[model samples]
Target: MSRADAYHKMLMSVSHFQHNIALILEAKALEASRSSQWLCHHLSAAQFGQNHGEQVKRSVEIHDHVLDVIDGLTKMEQALAKNMQALLGEPEAPDSGSLGDMLPLGGN
Candidate 1:
């Protein structure tokens, strides 16, 4: 494959990765919000210190950790997007072009 072909292929893969990460990040944000709401609702029913709250707090912490992971993934995807954009240049027609057109092996 030529340099352009290799560059395009890498760009396509990185773009796909970035898109997937974005979707995952959205889902994670929703999940974290729900978990936080649940934790707060459950904790508010109780008075002062109580063992029941510990489980809810732990659940919220777990969600927080997952959010942290998602945050890391988001950063990675951003870096990939920047590098891919620099490497591939801007889209000529605001379209990614079909795989059949972009592939080096004649879309095989």
Candidate 2:
């Protein structure tokens, strides 16, 4: 396969991953929100002497994992940008525009 073709395939794969990860992140956020609400309701009802630490810990762990995923995604995007710049033989200016804008028109 040509270099452009390979790059396009990689871009598509990353796009798919980003979409799937977004859905997963949304679900996780909802789960954490529900857990928080449940804990709040129970606490307000004067329920005491129960260990709520586990739920709080789980929420924190989820948040930390989400942050890690975000960091990885950011790095992936940066690497893709560098690869694109190299493939195009032009250094892309920061904040110039989307990668689509840099791609050649009419299948050059």
Candidate 3:
């Protein structure tokens, strides 16, 4: 390819990354909202059954928020993988980062 063609291709890659990132982010937000709503529904139902105490209510709130954040992060990661595939124009292996290496095996 000519220099101009190469430059155009580079620009296209960047554009694709930006567009896909936006789509994924929106998806993440939607997924998080759905999770929060579902949690709210179940918690409301549980509250109707009996008085579980303040502890239960507080725990439910904390769990709901944590789950929502985690689901959104998962969506973000999956979206990034899809974006990588698109940019490569082919199917590629997933990238897995393992933290085991960072931990000490044993204290001698």
Candidate 4:
């Protein structure tokens, strides 16, 4: 495959990885919110029987880890884009409010 084709494929793979991580983060946040609500309800009703706090804590940890992964991935993607541009001898293009600008990490 040509260098440009290979770069495009790699970019797509990274974009997919980011998308999946975002999905996981969304799910974890939802779980944490529900757990918190459940814990609050139990506490208000004076029925603190189950350990919902642990579940909430775990969910929060997962959410945080996902966020960290996203941050690192973003940095790596930016670096990769820069390196690829240098390798391809391409000049930086103006934004022009393209679709990529609307998507996260300049996804197409």
Clashing pairs in 1: none
Q: Clashing residue pairs, candidate 3?
A: none
Estimate candidate 3's alpha-carbon lDDT, on a 0 to 1 scale. 0.69
Residues 26-96 of candidate 1: C-alpha lDDT, one tens digit per residue:
99779879977986787563553567777678768777987889688767865675676578675433343
lDDT of 2 by residue, 16-103 (tens): 8778877877987798799889877775423433567765776688689879977987787677667766765787555554544555
**What are the per-residue Cα lDDT tens digits for candidate 3 across 1-108?**
997797678768767877986787799789879977987676664555665676578778878987987788767656765765675677643343332235434432
Q: Can you give the TM-score per candidate against the true fold?
A: 0.51, 0.46, 0.42, 0.45
User: Which whole-number lDDT from 0 to 100 does residue 50 have in model 2?
Assistant: 55
Instruction: Judging by TM-score against the true structure, name the best candidate.
Output: 1
lDDT of the structure predicted as candidate 2? 0.71
Sorting all predicted structures by lDDT, with the top scorer first, yields 2, 4, 1, 3
Better of 1 and 3 by TM-score: 1
Query: What's the lDDT for all of these models?
Result: 0.69, 0.71, 0.69, 0.69
lDDT of 2 at 86: 79
Give lDDT: candidate 4, residue 9.
Answer: 90
Clashing pairs in model 4, backbone N/Cα/C closer than 3 A = none
Best by lDDT: 2
Ranking by TM-score: 1, 2, 4, 3
